[model samples]
Target chain A: EAGVTQSPTHLIKTRGQQVTLRCSPISGHTSVYWYQQALGLGLQFLLWYDEGEERNRGNFPPRFSGRQFPNYSSELNVNALELEDSALYLCASSIRDRGPEQYFGPGTRLTVT
Target chain B: AQSVTQLDSHVSVSEGTPVLLRCNYSSSYSPSLFWYVQHPNKGLQLLLKYTSAATLVKGINGFEAEFKKSETSFHLTKPSAHMSDAAEYFCVVTGERTGRRALTFGSGTRLQVQP
Candidate 1:
């Protein structure tokens, strides 16, 4: 089976611009998670969506928001982006009932200038 | 609250030598642990996980981890290090709070294998 897939593998934007990164979960998976892997910061959880509902979030700002589609895909939107927002954004998914072993995607690298 | 810590920022070993990546976790409840490996410019791959079913869990690529509840540790190990094993390894802990499950990741340990 195909693994999780992300779009626009790389994104470039300037300060104050808005960016949207997309992810498609693996088949039969119901939970999608977003994480920010910034240099020196490790992987920080951003958002968690389950069954099309926002289940949980991390310690990020309001500018970091995302939504899940009916198809179990997800989109992370960063508003008024700052240079520090540049990082590798990863998306992971797993069967909600099964445990926390998530399958990850290649991630979308966002570079804000 | 739950947290994970990777003891080593980097470790260098020779080929055919044993590999050890240390990880410690703190959780109020029984936690689910995982080891993920990330290659250069690649996505994170699951090396192993512990979910209370087995104290010692074996994963892909000859990697394994032992979950010691008393010590609050989940350390990854490999019998022999290969050149392809050079990558960044992350230890993660998942726990539930207020009915929501969240994961806490460690800073990661970079492994370097010498020929």
Candidate 2:
């Protein structure tokens, strides 16, 4: 089976612009999660969606939001982006009923100037 | 609340030598631990996971991790290092206390294998 897949491997945007990253979960997976891997900041959780509902989110600002579709694919949106927002955004998916094990995607690298 | 700490920021080892990556975790309840490896410009790959079933969990690519509940540690190890094993490894933790299974990842340890 195919693992999680992400779109737009690399993106370049300027400050104050908006960006959206996409992810498609593996078949039979019901939970989608978003994470930001920034330089010096390491990896931090951004959002979690399951069964088309916003289950939980991290300490990130409201500017960082996302949603999961009925097919279990997800899209992360960043509004009024800042230089610090530039980082690798990764998406992971897992079977909600199963344990917490997750499979990851290649991630989209967003560069904000 | 849940968190993970990778003891080493970087480790260098020679080919055919043993490999050890240390990880410590904190959680309010029983935790699910995982080891993920990422190659340069590549996605993270699952190396192993401990989900309360087995204390000694073996994963893909000859990698394994032992979970020590008393020590709150889940360390990854490999009997023999290969050149392809050079990558960044992350230790992750999640628990029921962390609602919705939000994962807490470590700072990551970069492994370098010398020929």
Candidate 3:
């Protein structure tokens, strides 16, 4: 089976611009999660969507939001982006009922100037 | 709350040598632990996971992790290192106690294998 897949492997945007990153979960997976891997910041959870509902989110600001579609694919949106928002955004998927183990995508690298 | 700490920021080993990546986790309740490896410009790959079923969990690519509940540790190990094993490894943790599915990841440890 195919693992999680992400789109727009690399993106370049300017400050104050909005960006959207996409992810498609593996077949039969119901949970989609978003994470930001920024330089010096390490990896931090951004959002979690399960069964098309927003289940949880991390310490990130409201500017970082996302949603999961009926097919379990997800899209992360960043509004009024700042230079600090430039980082590799990763999406992961897992079977909600199974456990917490997640499979990650190649990630979308966003560079904000 | 849940968190993970990777003891080493970087580790260098010679080919055919044993590999050890230390990880410590904190959770209010029983936790699900995982080891993920990422190659340069590649996605993260699951190395192993511990879910209270087995203390010793074996994963893909000859990697394994032993969960020590008393120590709150889940350390990944490989008997023999290969050049392909050079990558950044992350330790992750999540628990039902948090009532959230978001995972806490470590700072990550970069492994370097020398020929």
Candidate 4:
């Protein structure tokens, strides 16, 4: 059983650029969540996708959006990235509506210069 | 506005010594609590969770936490510390709003296990 996996491991972009981060969940998981772990800001929930539907989102900007694929994989897109947008973005997944226990993937570290 | 707070920013303990990581939460409803661990460059791992069933919750790697409602705290503890246990630990609380369980995380506590 492979755990959640993320892509690009790291990314470097300048201000006003757009960055996309990807995540593939465990085989049987149906819910995927995105979280932004900015420096000194702790972890903030970005979005939640369940069964390909945009379920919930956090207090981030509209430029920060994401979606889920048919196979339960997810992609997070941060547009007009600013220096403050630099952070380790994490993706997690779990069985649908199964409460708060989520399996996480090694996050994608994005550095906006 | 629900929030989670880790009482200690860092803790140091020797091998085989007991370890404690304090957490406090504020919520209007009967809160759902969790503990997560993260090593450098890695994602957060679910240490344990309390879903109102049992006050004392045990997680992997011999870690446990007790939810005290009166004090509004859910503190993580371990009987013995191991070098492998050194990492950043986060205290989290889940908000039950509109049938969604959104987690509120605290500023992590860095645990150091001395050999």
Candidate 5:
């Protein structure tokens, strides 16, 4: 089966610009999650979307927000990007009722220069 | 609060050798544990999970992990390592009791397989 898929494997944007990352979950999956992996750092949870609702979010600022569509795809938006915002953004999806062994995507490498 | 700690930042093992990656988690209630492997430029692949089921969970790529309640640990292990097994491994725990869907991840351990 097709696994989780992310768009724009690499993205480059100037500081203060905004960027949007997309993710398509595996077939029949209902939950989508966003995470950020900063340079030399571990993955930090960003947002969680399920069944067209923004279910939960991580410790990120309001500048980082996302939404899930009825089709189960999701988009993460980051406004006023800073150099510190540069990192690998990953998207994962899984069944809402299943345990949280989320299948992640290849991730989009965001570079804020 | 829920947190995961990977005991080692990195581990190197020769092909055909046994592989062990240690992970410890702290949760006030019964937590769901998982092990995920991420290859270079690839997404995280689910190795296995323990969610109030069998203590020993086996996953793809000949990988498995056992959840030990006493130790508050969920460590990944393989009988033998393969060159293709080289990747970054993460231990995750979810708040099953708290009814949280988000999974808390560890710092991750990089497994280096030497042929």
Candidate 6:
């Protein structure tokens, strides 16, 4: 089976711009998670979506928001991006109610100038 | 709040040598622990996980981790190192008391294998 897939492997934007990153979970997976892997810092959870509902979120601000679709795909939107927002945004998916093992995607490298 | 700490930022070993990557986690309650490997420009892959079941968990690529509640650690180990094992390893903790399943990853330990 194909693993989780992400679109626009790399994204470039300037400060104050908005960016949207997309992720398609593996087949039969119902939970989608978003994480930001910045330089030096480790992977930080951003959002969690299941069954088209926002389940949980991290310590990030309101600017970091995301939504899941009926197909279990997800979209992470960043409003008024800052240079610090630049990082590798990863998307992971797992089978709901199964376990905590999540498969990840290649991730989108967002570069904000 | 819960957190994960990787004791070593980097570790170097010769091929066929044993490997050990230390990880310690802090949580008020029982937390689910996991080990993931990431290669350059690649996504994270699950090496193994412990969810209050067995103390020892085996995963892909000859990798395994032991969950020691007394030590509050879940350290990854391998009998023999391979060149392909050279990647960033992350120790993650989740399922905290708040019922949050989103993982809190460690700073990561980069493994270097010498051929």
Over A34-63, each residue of candidate 5 has an lDDT whose tens digit, in order, gives: 999986768998888889888787888999
**Model 6 chain A, poorest ten-residue lDDT window?**
A94-103
Q: List-wise, what DockQ does each model earn?
A: 0.77, 0.84, 0.85, 0.74, 0.75, 0.79
lDDT for A98 (candidate 2): 76
Q: Interface RMSDs of all predictions?
A: 1.3, 1.0, 0.9, 1.3, 1.4, 1.3
Local lDDT at A18 for model 3: 97
Clashes of each: 0, 0, 0, 0, 0, 0
- lDDT of candidate 1 over A1-113, digit per residue (tens): 99999998999999999999999999999999999999978899999999999999899999999999999999999999999999999999999877778889999999999
Question: Residue-wise lDDT of candidate 2 within A1-113, one digit each (tens)?
Answer: 98999999999999999999999999999999999999999889899999999999999999999888989899999999999998999999999877788899999999999
Window of ten residues with lowest summed lDDT in model 6 chain B: B94-103
CA RMSD, predictions in order: 1.0, 1.0, 1.0, 1.2, 1.2, 1.1
Model 6 lDDT at residue B60: 92
Q: Where does candidate 2 stray beyond 4 Å?
A: none
Model 6, global lDDT: 0.93
Per-model TM-score on C-alpha atoms: 0.98, 0.98, 0.97, 0.96, 0.96, 0.97
Give the higher-lDDT candidate: 1 or 6. 6
Q: Per-residue lDDT tens digits of candidate 6, residues A1-113?
A: 99999998999999999999999999999999999999977799999999999999889999999899999999999999999999999999998788877899999999999
Q: Model 2, clash count?
A: 0
Runs in model 1 deviating more than 4 A are: B96-98
| Residue lDDT tens for model 4, A1-113 | 99999998999999999999999999989999899999889999889999999888899989999889999999999999999999999999988666767889999999999
Give Cα distance to truth, residue A60, candidate 2, Å: 0.6
lDDT of 3 by residue, B19-95 (tens): 99999999987898999999998889988888889899999999999999889999999999999999999999988
The segments of candidate 5 whose C-alpha lies over 4 angstroms from its true place after superposition are: B97-99
lDDT per residue for candidate 4 within B1-115, as digits (tens), equals 7998899999999999999999999998778899999997889999999998989999999999999998999999999999999999999888766546567899999999999
